[model samples]
Target: MPRKRPGRVRTKNTNRREALKLSTMAPEDYNVRPGEVKSIACPNCRTWRRIMGETVLKIREHCISDKVADGEKHVTCPGSNQVVIIDIDVSHWQARQNRLLRDAMPQENRRAARQFYKPLPAPAAPVARIHAGVTLETARRAYLAHVEECVRCGTGQHCTRGGALAHRYVLVRKEELARRKAHKQSAPAARKALWDQRGGATVETANNQCRPRLDGAVSEYRGPQVPSKPLRVIA
Candidate 1:
């Protein structure tokens, strides 16, 4: 209950009212204002108890449970009559608490509470399609399967869903054909370039081998061969 104010020295615990020792607590521990019923959860017992005074707040003395006359030894709670001093400004603490509560709310729920918009049901999809990297054969099979199952599709026509599937299949087929054709046309040139590179490498290697050991350069990736004769050790 003791607070920092100019000129008035903080009274010692011995001099405090009700003979209860002073215990400093954070403003968040209890709810209080100029004209509201102040209450706090007892720290030791974890039970909600009304704060005891208007000018100075203190934790009320409380027993654990049954009274002495009940013949049950419930015992008194250790938190009895403990003085609580709220040092922080109540108004400032209240403002910060309000801001925190607002921030904690969900983004959707933070809007006006009076809003009564009904949530729209999610739109369902028809048969899911492989939008990317779909092979031509898979597309063709899917189109054929859809057409077979759909009664609206006939020998020379298709229903809307069947028609859409067929169109996708056609596009995939065209792309696959174009890719294969390009690969076929480029195969000869690719092979020729590969052959030319290999031929040049072969000729250069042959020339290097034919030039003999004039420069003492060892073959790549192969160390020099061991000498056939072991020398006699001179003692």
Candidate 2:
């Protein structure tokens, strides 16, 4: 029989401890210092073994799951071998820190530091409300929408605002109709004028010639006019 082999060792779970540490960590603790190499807790492993280099001063190298001397198995951190970009502008960060520091200081100290900027004063009187720009179609649609709801509303018949809106909508519709009618009438006249300019017979001359012919044919159709009422009544 073959000799029995040792089973693979399992890694310890330090998630709870890492969670506690994360809960207590301050905002400033995450800020990486310029020109300094530091070790931080690995995001995947939750262990303080991830090294941040000073050359780029950002996380470029991933965590390696190395075994401890006790022959225990280390958990395979998923973030291993993944390239991480930790680009932080030091000058902008320092400027933000300085601004925060200034804001936290007393007014007297701030006055000694530099001249403070003041915001513009608000206007004295409240500005009147201005109507938003809208097209004629949009205006007509809005008035119609109000009119539709106003009929079913509890206000019943005394809805003056709805009435006014409806009146305005009707006037708009009338104007639109007038515009369409004028366009229709002008189109034929325009075509006739263009045809006459191109040496064709004018529409007016054609109508004048046709009028007498039509009247004569109508007169020739009937023998004579017969009186509907009594001749005695006429006498």
Candidate 3:
């Protein structure tokens, strides 16, 4: 596409109230970097306005108050249509701006532009927590239920969550089997202990039921009785 035609340059006859030198103004307020359209902030209104015309750039005419259209008094900005002379070195101004920007940036972000960036590793899949009372039946039901609801699992495959549930089910099943095996192994010892306790009670009951048949001495082995007072030694 053809480039835009350069507008008229500043002629000696182009009357203006005052002229603004680019060097005298703040570097930030005016931009005249090479290859970019020139723009500057209006001194009175402080709004950025495009520089019209080639060779001799003029700030686009604008009002002092933007609210002038809304039944407000119209006052033209003093900087409007003001002639801007490019007196400063554009390259030097750009370099200083670059330095200032680099200094203002956060310390962590300053990096070599050409360096290879290692792509971040993909995020890990989320899984449900196994609470205190998770059991084999409950785990299996959960896995099956997830498989039924998930669209991805309908094709005889597991999604991330479904896979996690299936894994939990298998783990719970293994744990339950191991627990059952342990309980089976311990049953004989528990039974023997219970039998011993019952046997002792039965023997005590039988002894209580039977009274001594011998007369006169009543030769039952009773424990000695406590004395009423302490024995006194003869002095």
Query: What is the TM-score of each predicted model, taking all chains together?
Result: 0.40, 0.25, 0.43
lDDT of 2 by residue, 165-225 (tens): 5556566667778989999999999988888797685655766774446453335556447
The order of the candidates by TM-score, greatest first, is: 3, 1, 2
Report the candidate with higher lDDT, 2 versus 3: 3
Sliding window of 10 residues with minimal summed lDDT for model 1: 6-15
Looking at model 1, the pairs that clash are 1-85
RMSD values for the candidates in order, in angstroms, are: 13.3, 22.9, 15.2
- Winner on TM-score between 2 and 3 is 3
Give the per-residue lDDT of model 3 (tens digit) for 1-235.
6676555544443336668888888888887777777788888778988888876677777787889879999877777778778889889999998898899999999998889989999776444456358887788788878888899997888877877788788888888899999999999999889878889678778879856565544334652364447999999
Off by over 4 Å in 3: 1-15, 115-235
Residue 94, model 3, lDDT: 98
Q: Report the number of clashing residue pairs per model.
A: 1, 0, 0
